[model samples]
Target: MLHIWGRLSSINVRKVVWAAQEVGVAFERTDAGASFGVVNTPQYLQLNPNAMVPVLQDGALTLWESNTIVRYLCARYAPGRLYPEPLAERFNTERWMDWQQTALNPAGRHAFLQLIRTPVELRQPELIRQSNDETEHLLAILDAQLGQHAFVAGAQFSMADIPVACELHRWFGLPQARLPHRHIERWYQTLRERQASQGVLDLVLS
Candidate 1:
C-alpha cells in the first residue's frame, strides 16, 4: 500500500489526496506537519529532506513535492484520464499547474496568511489590501480562461484542475472586496460538487 505523510488541513497534502481519490489508489495517511510534528523527525527527514507535509512512499520509491506526487500518481495509475494522453494536451495541462505555482499561489498565500493565519490585532491592513488586490488580478486571468472552457483543459477535468481548484476555495472563502468574474464562480460551483474536491480542497483556510 502507498503511505502518505501530511496533515489533513494542508493544501499541498490535499492536492495529493485529491489526486489519489481521483485515481482510486489505496493509500494510508499519517499526520506529520504543523501540530502533528512528524515532519521534523529524523526518520521523516530521511524520506523527504525538505521535511514537507506530503511525502509519498510506495515500495522503495519515495517522492515529495505535492504537484510532482499528483502527476506521478495520475500517470502511474489513471494515465490518459487525470493525466493527459497527448503531449500537447499534457503540456497544456502543465501550463496551468505552472501558472498556479508561479502566480496564483503567491497571491493566495498572502490573502490566506493575512485573513486567516494572522490575528486581527497583529494583522497588517496594508498587506491584506495588497494581497486582496493581487488575488483579484490573478483571478481575472483565470476568469478569462474559464470563460472559454468548462475545465482548465477545455472540456474534461484533469490534474491541472487540482492546484487551481484548491486556491479557488481560499479565494472564494475569504471576505474580499469584490470579484468581477461570474464565470470563475460558476466553475468553482462545478468543482464544489465533486466528492474528492469537497473532501480535500473544501476546508477552512489556515
Candidate 2:
C-alpha cells in the first residue's frame, strides 16, 4: 500500500496526488503541514528531515521531494504512459519539471503569499508587483511553447505537465489583472478536463 502525507492545499502535495491518480495508485493520504502540522514529529522527521509535505511511504522505503516522488510513482507504475521513453523525450520532460521548481514557482510565490496567505495590512505591494511581472514573463515563455506543442513536453500528457500545470493553476487562481495568455488558457482548460486533474487542479487556491 502507498501512503502519502500532506494537506491537499499544497501545490507540491497536489502534484503527487494528481500523478498517483493518473497512474491508478491505491494510496491513503494523511493531512500534514500548515494548520495540520505533523512535519516536526519524530516519526514524520524519519520520513523527511526537511519537514516538508507529500512524503511518500512505500513499504520500508520513504520518499520526499514532490517532483522526484512524481517521477518515481510514474516510472514504477505507468512507465509507458506518464513516464515517457526515448532519450530526447525523457530530457524534455525533466527540463520542464525542473523549470517549474526553479523559475515559475518562485516567481509566482509572492502573489500567492500576499493575495492568499498574508493579511492585507501585512502584504507587500512592490514585492507582489515584481513577482507578478516575473511570473508573467516566465509564463509567457511557457505560452510560447504551448503554442507549438499540445502539452508541456509534447502531445502526450507526461510527468512534465503535472508540476508546471499545478503551478499555473495557482497563478490563475490569484485575483488580479492577468496578461492575456491564450495558449496557457487553452492548455489549462484541457488540463481541467482530465479526470486526474479534477480535484487537484480545479480546487480553489490556498
Candidate 3:
C-alpha cells in the first residue's frame, strides 16, 4: 500500500491527496505536521531530511516534496490520463506546475499568512497589500491561460491543474475584493465540482 505522511490541513498535502484521487490510486494518509508534530521527529527526519509535511512511502521508495509526489503518483498510476504523454505536452503541463510553486505560491504566502494565520492586531497591512497585489497580478496571467484552455493543459484535466488550483483556492478562499478575472473563476468553479478537489481544494484555508 502507498502511505502519505502529512496533516490534512496542509495545502501541500492537499495537492498530493487531490492528485491521488485523480489518478484513482489507493493511498493511506497519516497526520504528521503542524499541530500533529511527527515531521521533526528522528524517524520522520530519516525518511525526509527536509522534514516536510508530505512524505510518500511506497515499498522500498521514500519520497518527499509534494509536487514531486503528485507527479510520481500520476505518472505511475494514471500515465496518459493525469500525466500527459507527448514530450512537448508534458513539459508544457509541468511548466505550469513549476509556475505555481515559484510564482503563485510565493506571492500568495504573505497575504495568506497576514489574513488567516496572523491575528488582526499583529498583521502588517503593508505586507498584505504587497502580497495581494502580486498574487492578483500572477493570477491574471493564469486567467489569460485559462481563457485559452479549459484546463491547465488544453481541454483535459492534467497534473498541472492540481497544484495551480490548490494555490488559486487559497487566494480565492480568503475574504477579499471580488476579482474580475472571469476565466479563473470559471475554471475554479469547474475544479470545485470535481470529486477529486471536493475535500482537499474546497477546504477552509488553515
Tell me how far the alpha carbon of residue 66 in candidate 3 is from the true structure, in angstroms, after superposition: 0.9
For all candidates in order, the CA lDDT equals 0.86, 0.93, 0.89
Give the winner by lDDT: 2 or 3: 2
> Which 10-residue window of candidate 2 scores lowest in summed lDDT?
80-89
Clashes of each: 0, 0, 0
lDDT of 2 at 127: 90
User: Which is better, 1 or 2, measured by TM-score?
Assistant: 2
* RMSD to truth, every model: 1.2, 0.8, 0.9
Residue range 158-201, candidate 2, lDDT tens digits = 99999999998888889888899899899999999999887898
Ranking by TM-score: 2, 3, 1
Per-residue error for 57 in candidate 2, Å, reads: 1.0
At residue 85, candidate 2 shows an lDDT of 75
Per-residue CA lDDT of candidate 3, range 1-206, in tens? 88999987888999998988888878899999898998889999999999888999989999998899999998999999888889999999999999999899999899888889999999999998999889889988888999999998789989999999998888877777856899988998999999878788768878
User: What's each prediction's TM-score?
Assistant: 0.95, 0.98, 0.97
Instruction: Please list the residue runs of candidate 2 whose C-alpha ends up more than 4 Å from where it truly belongs after superposition.
Output: none
The TM-score measured for candidate 1 stands at 0.95
